[model samples]
Every structure is written in C-alpha cells, then in structure tokens.
Target: MYAMPNNDLEEATPWLDSGEQQVWRRWLVATAQLYRYLDEGLRPHGIDLAEYDVLVHLSEAEDHRLRMGELAGQVHLSRSRLTHTVSRMESQGVVLRRTASHDRRGVVAVLTDEGMALIESVAAHHVRAVRRAFIDAIGRKDLMVIDRSMAAVIAATDPASGPPDH
Candidate 1:
C-alpha cells in the first residue's frame, strides 16, 4: 500500500467551537437513540418508522391514496426505495398500487382497510413513544424552542419549503 500523503490543505480545516461540538455530538447520539427507541416500539407492528410514515400519509390522503412520486417526496425517500417499500407492504396486504385515474402514467398507493386499522391501532403507541422519547424528555417549556430551532434549520436547509405547512 502507498503511504498516505500529508498536506497543509488537510490541516486547514474549520471546526465547530467547543460548545457547538458538544451539542453536535449529543444531537447526533440522541437522534440515533431516539429513532432506535421508537423503532423498537414498532417492532411488533411489523413495520419501522418509514413504513409507519407511509401508512400515515396514505391514511391522511384524499380517498386514502397518493401518487407514488408525491409519497416519496413526503417521506423523504427516493422513488426507487419507496417503490421497494411499497412492494413489500403490498405483499403484506397493507397497501395496493394502481395506475392513477387522472394520470395513467403515474401510480398511486392506496391504504387498505387493513392498513387503516393497523395505523389507527398503532397511532396511540407511536404517540406514547414520541411523548416519552421526545416531548417529555425535552419538557414542555423547551418544546417551543426545539420546534422553532428545527423550523429555522428547515428554513435554512430547504428554502423552497419555507416554514412547515403542518
């Protein structure tokens, strides 16, 4: 193997200040832990957070259906990944896909009665998990702070979206 090259460019890095670094590391670990904690609660439901999110969007959609492309964007998943996830859910009889009525070229994912009932059943559990893992942990007084901070981050990161509609 060739020896690694040392360069001044590599040493000229700009790093976070100590306070920011502490918060950044904590935020990283906390997010991972929170996600895993919530996902564990959904384990018996046979779906992870991503699948649950899909179920929720489909359930809230008009006539319980949304075009695949829209679903992918809403869920922050790439089209191919959403297709794969929906395929699996289809096999599990939770969702079904059909060509869009208004747009023949587009496909729509529809939530079945089983899916509706499943989400309704799990919603309470998910809410409890959210409360325990996030809201309660952060406390009510700081909740707005967290929300505002996230909104600012979103505004900065996703200028197209602006403030959250929801």
Candidate 2:
C-alpha cells in the first residue's frame, strides 16, 4: 500500500472514482506483465529493455550516432543514467564515445559494428515478442483505438505537442 502522509486536505483535490481506480490498477498490472515478458525475451542478448532502447535509438539515428543529451531525451533516461549505460557499452566495445567536434566538452554515442550486430541479432526476437504480446492479441479496431488513445494521452501530457523525441 502507498502511504500518503497525514495532512489536512482543506482544499479541493482531484481524485479518481472507483471505476477510474480499477482502470488505473488494471493498466498498471498489464503494463508490468508486458514489460517483464519483453525484458525476459531480451535477457539472452545480455541487454535489458533500457539498454536495448538506447541501442535502437542510436542505430536509427543519422550516422548511427547521437549526442548524449539527445540520446537521453530519446530514451527517456536521465543524463546520469545514460552516461552510465554508455560507459558500460563503451567498455564492451558495443558503442564508441567521442568528444563532440563542435563542443569538445560534450560527448556523442556512436554505435560500433558490434553494437549493430547485436541489435540485428535481437531485433527479430524483439519484434516477435511485441507482435505476440500486443499486436497479435488485439483486433485491428482495438489496435487502432489503442494507438489513438495513446496519441491523445501523449498530446495531453507532453509539454510540446510536436513530434516526440525520435
């Protein structure tokens, strides 16, 4: 149970009703289960979801590289966490870190040959997992609804309604 500190709530506060609470709970459960399935699927490749995400983002970038700050934004990771992840990948020769040419103090992450190979090996399985767990389980109409719903939620929550970090 999440413990809320005992504080007098004299002012009005938004709260979910029972139905809304149930929906939130179910969403949480489903998301957790899906994450676990995907994480397990990638474990044999010696990378977790976060690391794989970093790899994918880097691989898809122009010249297969991106600045650390840009990568953090694309992966939804804090700068510090991205630094640590990149450091580990660098040590494994899966990624190369270079000082930015324009800003010597800044760093860029480039996918090495090994990193590309690793992603190539894992991509097929990852796609299958995604398809089996999500797309295959939903009807075409429901999938459309899910996509639209997610887009709407993101538009509502994101500070910039523009394109997401890609």
Candidate number with greatest TM-score: 1
Please, what are the lDDT tens digits per residue for candidate 2 over residues 35-152? 9999999998899888899999999999999999999999999999999988988888899999998999989999999999999999999999999999999868899999998898
Q: RMSD in Å for candidate 2, one decimal?
A: 4.7
lDDT of each: 0.90, 0.89
Clashes of 2: 0
Model 1 residue 22 CA deviation in Å: 0.8
* lDDT of model number 2: 0.89
